[model samples]
Target chain A: MSAPFTDAQLAAFLTGTLEDETLIDAIEAAINADPALATRAEALASAEPMDASVREAFAPVLDAPVPERLIAAATPRAAEVVDLAAARAAKSAAPLPTPANDTGRSSWRWPQFGAMAASLALGVLIGGPLLKGGGAGAPEGGSLVLASADLTAMLDSAPSGQKTDLAALGEGEVVLTFRNADGLLCRQFLIEGKGGTTSDALACAGGNGTGWQIEAYGRRAAPVGEMKLAGGDAAPAVVAAVDAMIDSDPLTGADEIAELGKK
Target chain B: MNPDDTTRQALIALIPRLRRFARVLTGSIADADDVVQAALEKAMVNLEQYQPGTRLDSWVFRIARNHWVDDRRRAHNRMGHDDIGEMLDLAGDDGVAVVEASAEARMVRAAVDSLPPEQRDVVALVMLEELTYREAADMLGLPIGTVMSRLSRAKAALAKRIAAEGTVQ
Candidate 1:
């Protein structure tokens, strides 16, 4: 006998905001009696905000690599500490002669002092030597840069979670594969060369089939007595970079293989 | 470990969620990133004011919401613009599998975007961000009844728009 419920009332009811019990009962009775009203109410209930499609649209961003600037902003001012630790470790390894004039190589025993001098001298030349020559295939400046062809093959065809034989192509091993925040396929790899030096690098698929772009690269600081190789666990810096960019969990083994096969 | 470090770690873990919420609020990727960055800087500056043993996510979300509201006010003053609907489109360059899916997603975003700013904020807080009604009200400094009313209206408006667009069954 009561007037039929309006769409706004029904919506409020669906959200549990409607308070009048008698009116609520009437609306319920009307919904049960009229199939049209029931269908409308069902649709209204299902189309809530943050629906599946909306969430799906954002999946790539959720899995995206966090931007480096954001990471830098969030990271504590501890790089100096890390550098000191590295220097101390380096110093204790070998006995060095004290400096004669208190200005030159004698102060090199202090890692910070030596590093400052080295930086001032090689500030411009630093990034140059770090760059590797094209197709020379040698690890340069402690980190290994993957060749375009090999990097492409690994990103396109290599299954994640399983180590692939990258030895034939280079001195590195593919540790894992994941999708960055932008939905680009990314792989984390470790390369070891002479003198127990190791490097961790993250590469993502370039746009328009340009092959992989190395996003982040860093040397794995060896412990005082032992060198750590890239394995199931990535270096802390590499992990931080990954954490910044990853919006979701890395793909499962089956999912990674299937995704690789798609390309 | 320093308390700041712990809070910083927790904040870092919440970045993805914050980014998603920012995307919804700003309705533009570039704007969302800027808002997030600004909120982060503000939070870091006021880190000492944050109460320990409380929900850091909610705290930071409030900061983000405040920053967004302030940014909108500034934009409104500078541009003398009231057209907030233009930025609602969230379609990205990533290739979705099916065209139909993409269209439906766009429709959903547009529907949410069409709501009035206050209503949209409530929807973003309660529905999209999965905050409880009380939490949303607390974040928005509104009464519980007001939050529910706004949400109801938002849901109704969205349903009507979606139905009218023929994007949903």
Candidate 2:
């Protein structure tokens, strides 16, 4: 009965910008009546999120090393210090690597800055099963090995300042506690694994409250004797991830105790 | 840090998004990088002109779009070809993983690439980059109503082309 909606009206309806409720009802009624209109509307709605796929296609570019040419171009230089030809020569001599390959699974191959390279390592090392490995009771494939369910229990229940000897599981302690942007409580721990390998990890409370999701992690050689430093000594990637995701600074000693008390 | 240093850092952070926008606009990675390089240079030289509180990404995006338009004009004059031919060339050369995507995905990409330059620009900013319509209008120096109309027409055209392909398959 109602006049068929125009393409613009249909588009507005799809984008949720069409505020006319009466018109929207009319359009819906029309669409229900007309199979062709329904098919077109469905196609448009499905195609709308194609941007997500586009973003995914380019996601690797975010982790790729920022090209030296762009970095140099962005760097501020005084007039007297400018040498345009030399910069051009350097750019041409060391061209940035291309992003594509035959199989199209582009590797992170560019010469990355120290911090970004460390972040790449952290992402590669901890991104898969380790992050999803849940808490101590999580299925086997997790990088962290617990001595007993007790250590897992302690990790789940330990307060920010609670320092327990995890030597039986792996020599380390739960060093810090804070909340992430999502307001989930998180713990940072340093552990010495087999072969004197030290790893630092940040784990946030999983949704069900029974486990944790490892948000960031890194591994390096352990110091000869001393326990690894907590804040400053953290891996660059780990520190950066924490700084980005943490809602605020690590809870103060009293605040941490109070937080633990509530749990 | 000085204002230049701060702006430079911000620009560095924005490079990935800018590159993505450029790829969509130019429809080729090589041309997209060239556009990005030129725009970054222009923005850096004129960093003092950039206001402190405004959205820096929008400003740079506008610069990139302007540079793209200029390059298109020059290419048109040099080759004695119309914009449609150039757009077709770009669609053919869209090297953003044609081999890896599904046939449907490639079809959608090609359909987008085949849009008119004005429509394609609007789609890239509003759809791909997820800019608000008002922001896109501001960046493109068009009225908001014009942007919505162009986007409406572009989406309809893309849907039609994709449907035709589906039917053929």
Candidate 3:
């Protein structure tokens, strides 16, 4: 008990890192012979500080079979190394980076360009069919005919749920009809281009129907199953736009036909 | 066995220990796997650079620490905060463990988890991993005295917290 060993000395002695053999022997003898030294030495043991609770808390991690994902990561693979933090962030946010939302370049000239629309500056590589111009093509990807007279004509003429193929804009269909804030008639439309490329747009035009401007435009992969556009789902962004602009419950049946018929 | 196969086997054998160590670094079971995966991938990529005859576990431990540190930094830089609560994986196993640890281990884990990252890491390396002071210093790139002080401080803090919790109960 007179062995005057500090906690550090006791720790070092317990770990067998003490260079002084004589002192080590003396401490071991004293610890074995003296109850107090034995108690302090026992507490200084590496496993002692960790205690039984920590052992229980940690033992399952050791006993549980290694997850398959972990085993795959350990094996040296040639590619598909993910950025762990970025992956975690993405996982926290939403769905995996599927080509569904790959058309990140906003073909829409967003009016007022508020916070939600500003999230369109994505680094996703644009893919899918070109915006085939009335001529040959606009570009392979990323560029589309945002606004045009042909689109305006389609907007004025196309009946709801009926597909209208425009010279500039691909096969387009008006899904629903409503009035914009200015009482100008607004039409929500879906256009499908080649290679599974799809655009959902809402446009407002006046009586002459010559001045069609897109109020909201969103690009997403066509939904699974049949490609019907009447009373169907739309991307949240496009839905939000319709929610913001619609001044009345959507026109239905003969009323919608009468509105389009006026043009 | 070929050296490559041998190395792979050794790395595989160390997974459980690595996993245990990772759980200490990240409180959640899932985040620990993320850290472990990133570290192992990095180790495999740089396998030739790993000096043979040296401790494979320690080398991978260093890699794991680096990966976790880099992940935290990237998360902080992107989010403008260091909380990293959202960055961590969902603690599905933790809920089950908490139900199990309702006896007393819950308080122990809470105390351990509450320790600062540096001290907590020290505790993991010394108390859990059972590294000597010199080995931990070498792996962490910290001085031996710093390792000793941190480990000692962590031990004292855990003891104090557990004792205080016992009194309250």
Candidate 4:
């Protein structure tokens, strides 16, 4: 605040970093004598000030309860220890030695080849699955192969309310769900456009499908009770709900086969 | 409790705070969660290397910072520009606390959200968390002068951005 106090001292004072008692008194004394200095000091406090409302906007995240799944996920298990060791050993095998002091290896020359090889390896590792029609990683549990003629006919029918809404859509897809080995429902879908502007959900239990009421007029992912529609055709949200319902055990083969006819 | 169990419990307890820091850093809850999960996994695997008396929160946060920085670098390398615009848009024009926001408040929030990552991170650590310069420097692995310069530039930039928004309003 004082004319003699440097901007550094003033900044330190504004940030609550000035710890010396003598310096604090001198700064205050200088600020009191010159109203302009007081104004300058005050300006420092308000400069780049945080808005109260921005803090309020994020306050909920600061207070929201941590999900149980996240808690379970955070806990380290013996399996992770095993995985970590294996990963470390895999890494150590290369060692990236100090080039052995030019033992027929130019540091600069080898680096370029090494990088090219790594990139090629990465490309192949990622591209191999995509080229195979759908990777094995594609959610497999929720796929319900429906053989019902009535349901198949409805999908291709012109007047069965199955026509996709093009106006309200930018990019969207319909999700299909079915049980998997883990008993969790998985989902897949055909996205119409770039950003899922017109997507369909094929869930049967909770989330966006079951727990919340789906409007009667909105396009549904698959047929429901008393409506014989496609099996394994639901939204990802619906699939999540179905997965949540079957937590511990896989849905039996007979029950899944029966769903194709009833729904 | 076994050391493994104790360490797990402590790490779990830090998740909320880690998430808060991550939200400040990434400006998106989904991104923040991803950062937190990645940081937690790294911390668990490297638990043996962590000194018992040191602050676990700071250690984990360092990992989060590194992970996000690496992600930013990779994204820049691949896309040639930060594609976080989609993430910012995902929260929607109407945030969850709309009832409390007036037109002016909304403008301020938008301005904060629009800040560049470098400036945004300083505000998150120094202003929001109130960390000392030395502590922040250590956390970010930067010199104290570098931290001050970054914070100073950030403040100046925020002033210009806010003034511009006020003029528009």
Highest DockQ: give the candidate number.
Answer: 3
Q: Candidate 4: misplaced stretches above 4 Å?
A: A1-9, A12-54, A67-69, A78-263, B76-98, B102-106, B163-169
TM-score of each: 0.46, 0.43, 0.45, 0.44
Give the winner by lDDT: 3
Predicted structure with the largest TM-score when compared to the true one: 1
Give the alpha carbon lDDT tens digit for every residue of A70-165 in model 2: 564555544212332332233334322223223333332223324344333343343322322221111111222222343456566666545565
Query: Which residue pairs in candidate 3 have backbone atoms (N, alpha carbon, C) closer than 3 angstroms, thus clashing?
Result: none
- The CA lDDT at B107 in model 2 is 60
Candidate 4 TM-score, C-alpha based: 0.44
Off by over 4 Å in 3: A1-52, A76-263, B77-102, B167-169
- How many Å off is the CA of A32 in candidate 3? 29
Docking category of candidate 1? incorrect
lDDT for each residue of candidate 2 in B1-169, tens digit (9 for 90 to 100): 8877888889988987887687778866556666777788668656777999998998899998898898787663222112322333344634545443434545666677678789888788878777766677678887554565566567667767867886332
Task: Give me the overall lDDT of model 2.
Answer: 0.58
Q: What is the C-alpha RMSD of each candidate to the true structure, in Å?
A: 19.8, 23.5, 20.4, 22.2
Model 1 over residues B17-101: C-alpha lDDT tens digits?
A: 7777777777665556666766775576467779999889899899988988977875532211212222222323335454555
Candidate 3, residue A82: the lDDT equals 30
Q: In model 1 chain B, where is the ten-residue run with the lowest total lDDT? A: B77-86
Give the alpha carbon lDDT tens digit for every residue of A1-263 in model 3: 63598999988765445667577666656664666765676566565635455565466567667876567656533222232223234433433233444344433232333323322221011122322211011111112223444555667776776777654345777877888767878887776654445666666773454455554455653442442332323433344455556676568678887876764
The alpha-carbon root-mean-square deviation between model 4 and the true structure, to one decimal in Å, is: 22.2
- Candidate 2, which CAPRI tier? incorrect
